[model samples]
Target: MALRIVSADERLSAAGAKTTMAIFGPSGVGKTSLLKSLPPAETLCIDLEAGMKSVQDWPGDSIPVRTFADALDIGCLVGGVNPSADPSGFFSEAHYQHLRESYPDLVQMIAGKRIIFVDSITDLTRQAMAWAKTRPEAFSDKTGKPDTRGAYGLLAREVIGLLKHLQHAQAKTVIFVGILERVTDEFNRTTWQPQMEGGKAGRELPGIVDQVITMSLFARDGDGWRHEPERGEDRRLVCRAGNPWGLPAKDRSGRLDVTEPPDLGALLSKINATRKG
Candidate 1:
């Protein structure tokens, strides 16, 4: 086969580029409500946590993901198969083709949708771990007993594969929302991390997406801890790397400000406005 070269102009086309983002925030900070900021016609939410009450009035479509199987199916269906992966493995071309035959209606359900929204990764990780526990890898071969290490290892692979599958969708933006947890070390240093069952998925997630955002409530008093708006705090998204606070955030686009208003639609617009005409 001849060496097929794709020109830089073709590769950097604005229409061909899309954003993959991971937004983390503390619970009850209205993370799910960010969906409302996006165009209803272009957005599809994968409600993993069953926490759609926050955006009950948002007139957009959502698919309820109740199990790990549902997550894999939806991800493969929406994102398409990774041909480079093992053909026999899950989320591969074979698995995706089988899902297409099983779920014929999913195509029309997601028609014209450009943004794939996952409500929360925390619940998704839990579901993945629960399913992992049932697999043979989660049991010791000799003792036939439960193996936490094996289960977590499998869980990490499943979650990362699913996320990367979604991120591969062409000309479509994939946004994963996750719960952020505050941690205090022995040295009295406070740090934040994504709230997932296994540490691997959260730790590796930043490398999988173009952006890592931390959504939080900021007050005039310089404390971002209060969850109550009545207490004079407003929601903000930390979009830049190396913020003064120990928040996990990065912007690969090199366009966003240190803090942005909590709006998914606007955030995406800025990220995608890089290519020339």
Candidate 2:
């Protein structure tokens, strides 16, 4: 063991912050629909679970990452996949091993990209459960309780691995989308919850992303419904992140904020427009 040291302080760019976004909300909410309008050429969608083809109406080429390793292949980084009836996009274990073995190469490829999109990180949590099912010893330890060892461990590894990839990306921007599911709570009759709210892996995702958004479709109020100012709205959707929607909303110019349930498209358009001005 001779003397060898590596410098910790490394700065190679004059660019700004890295964008890692998470869109969270209940089912039937317009997470994917909103993001569909985004420039697919710049944003790469890694879809593990989907009902979005018809819903989002994405128009481009698709390269499937059935297993984790498949993601490591730069070829799978294909940009345009015209929407069809086929669903071959997802993450799997076989792909995971391939990714692990070819990690360095994938990291390099991701570094060169702008927006890296994970359709839903929720599938990875399920994948973690599947991964845990393989470990006999860990399974035996928590025989009755929730099995959180194997799959959860692997999920953590995968997420951390991707975050590590983002560090090398100069103009990096990442968006992770997960469906919103309702969970019954002691206080409310049935409250909305991010599908990833439970489990070991669920807890880790929010911290990694820059902002988390929750979108929902609400019933009309007044004669037919309760807990609202008025009624007759087609589908009442509120976008809440830091606080309650709290009145309609104000535009940047001190005007009216038009969109109801905010999605990637609205946000991106605003951001892009602001830059142009």
Candidate 3:
């Protein structure tokens, strides 16, 4: 229960190279396609959906794919997937012990990354739900959002904490990908249309890291010249500064330059130099 420091100075210089983010949007918005654009060095992503295989020429194999249980399976990993009502968080102590016995090397391997991308946080959140189901039949809260002591919430907290810890201790850049959840709009004030929101965990992310980039899309830019483009009017990734589902970027200030061809090595170089400086 000790407080862990997450300063850029404290994090490994390798991991402190770039900002952490959450790329989120409605389905078919090309989230998977865009990640292929990032250079693995400046931005390595942990494949949760395993869709990295679809993209050719991306050295995605550089990033490791792991589940919350995968981390808990190893030692020195205190928090991650736990018991919950959702099927994903439904891990048991036996499963944890099994991971320790079976995949002991998982933590060491994961701890050695520059950028840690948790692709498709939707699945990650579901995994938390799974852990909730495994808790002993005690202190029930069907609300699905358990208190920190409750089963579901506890597991969710652990997973979130473990991720934050990875950022602080390992110095890996963290990117959590998820679908945007829509909530009633209270800010627009102009007709108050329904707005999009991130997953349940997104609500509390501001408390942990330095920055959270939300990759969101509004409307398809007329195929946007599938092959290439000549200007800002033709980018694919809808990126915002703080939260993916927060609001649309006003201009080119905080948007993903998806039009910037998918050159992994180049993007990574930029990220690393920034870290070195």
Better of 2 and 3 by lDDT: 2
Ranking by lDDT: 1, 2, 3
In model 2, the runs with Cα more than 4 Å from the true position are 1-17, 50-52, 55-57, 68-113, 135-154, 160-168, 186-190, 218-242, 245-263, 269-277
Local accuracy of candidate 2 as per-residue lDDT tens digits, 93-206: 344345546665654554445666676666645654454456553354535545555545656665555543443344655666676665667887665556752354456555
Better of 1 and 3 by lDDT: 1
**Top-TM-score candidate index:** 1
lDDT of 1 by residue, 192-270 (tens): 8899998899888999999999998776545433333335368889898988666889999888988889988888888
TM-score of 1: 0.92
Q: Pick the candidate with the highest lDDT.
A: 1
For all candidates in order, the CA lDDT equals 0.86, 0.48, 0.47
What's model 3's overall lDDT?
A: 0.47
TM-scores vs. true structure, each candidate: 0.92, 0.59, 0.56
Candidate 3 on 1-277: residue-level lDDT in tens? 4668777655545443545555554454456666565555444455655666556566654433354555434312323334432443324445545555665665455545555666666766565556655655324467644344565555556666555654443444565556654444578442111111223345555455543333333333465423121222233443333332244222222223433233333433444443324
Off by over 4 Å in 1: 1-3, 14-17, 221-232, 275-277
Per-model RMSD to reference: 2.8, 9.7, 8.3
Where model 3 places Cα greater than 4 Å from the true spot, the runs are: 1-18, 40-45, 62-67, 74-112, 137-149, 185-200, 218-277
Report the C-alpha displacement of residue 154, candidate 1, in angstroms: 0.4
Cα RMSD for predicted model 1: 2.8
